[model samples]
Target: MSHLHIRPKEAGADKRIINITPESANWQFVGFEVVMLEADDTLVVNTQNTELCAVIISGVADVTTQEQLFSNIGHRASAFDGIAPYAVYAPPKQELTINALTSLEVALCRAPAKGLYPVKLITPQDCVTMTRGSGTNLRHIRNIMMDNVDAERLLITEVITPSGHWSSYPPHKHDTDAIPQESALEETYYHKLNPKQGFAFQRVYTDDRSIDETISVEHNSVVTVPKGYHPVGTPHGYELYYLNVMAGPKREWIFHNDPDHAWIVNP
Candidate 1:
């Protein structure tokens, strides 16, 4: 199966821009969708049997759930704004109605859940924004809902790589649960380019080169990593942004980096 899945802007139908489920991606866990809503428009979302993280990529929206209501929960004009975006989490069986106060773009990340966690509205202050790597490998990461967060099996975050830099550098893989070394997890990347016409390159491969692919991704592209070491690079003159969704048997973010290039992280 192809690891790279692209969903172009014009491919959206009925406000659903991108949709990926366990059955669609052929993964046991993790699913995602990108939704666009016009001003004053509303959409009802049911978590059903999965836990979901709804991230507001752009514009303001009011999210109403059975327990509480979040009014005007977003403010970033675009994904490239360098501002921390707002996100909401809902556990299984919860229903949420979202009313767009302006033209909005929301990313829904889902994963199978066995317990019902409380609904949470993750504001900008709640996010942990950090810089990773160094020099040419520098990138910004926004941990929206991490392991410390109250969730059953989902981890959500976003990363921004400047031009000519690497984001998921050193080629990391977490397809096994080798405690203190790595944890098995399924992941997906939903990408967006600054100029829209620009593109980036991503490589998904295994240590033995059994499964390897170098994919060229553009705006609104989605890439799934079932099991492999994945790394991405942004070309000069273009910035790259990707929303990352991950899920697995364990609620941890441990990973093992490629031994060959592991020195890059230290040197």
Candidate 2:
């Protein structure tokens, strides 16, 4: 709808956005955008009590975390005591510098496990679980040794869909603990455009033919999962990127889609 939305409570409310700041650092319950640099510049960051997983969305920078120095282009970094201290140096000529943080300036954004969960940079070599069932080339980042942690409540997956094809097309929902056969944990969707200048469509609502809601999604947009089946659509001219976050009481994240459309899994 607007630039962004945030669903603070898990009720049936719409999404909202919160401005990013270093002093008020907290986990974003839905998600937040962190602007690292305006142009070729340097940024010194100070974290409070929150751990941060900063993913380099665009542009290049020389990042220094603790005693380790990560330099050059196309790199991501994670910091446990991100609330402690970190520094970044942007490259010459690159205009925009943005980094997506796991938890930022929010109250409910979840954090990594209690044990030693190392911060890792995902690479093409680390892409695992290439599945064909989802009608796209879906690779995941959770199975890695560095990404696996006990306090990590969210699982991030990346999907590349062909133009005119579907990714999360079947429309599914996981809103209860009814049974493993039909129930699942709640989830959140964060989208990114492949062309870096395109948009897609998404649908979320009850299956009983009541309470239907459709959202026109673009890059840096977010959708919420309350208690209904949701399906994502990618247009013929554009590809898509979506990050899913899930949590529940059973300590396991699972789901169940609409029954009639569930047959799409076979076709």
lDDT of each residue in 1-267, candidate 1, tens digit only: 354665645534357878888998887899898899999989999999998899999999999988999998999999999888999998889998999999999998999997567899999989989999789999999989985477988988899999999988899999998877899999999999999899999999998889899999889889889888999999999999999999999889899999999988766
The lDDT of each candidate is: 0.89, 0.46
Cα lDDT of model 2 overall?
Answer: 0.46
lDDT of 1 at 255: 92
What are the TM-scores, per candidate, against the unseen true structure? 0.96, 0.61
lDDT of 1 at 124: 91
Query: Which RMSD does model 1 reach against the true structure?
Result: 1.4
* Local accuracy of candidate 2 as per-residue lDDT tens digits, 68-118: 456553433321111111222121122222222232211122323332334
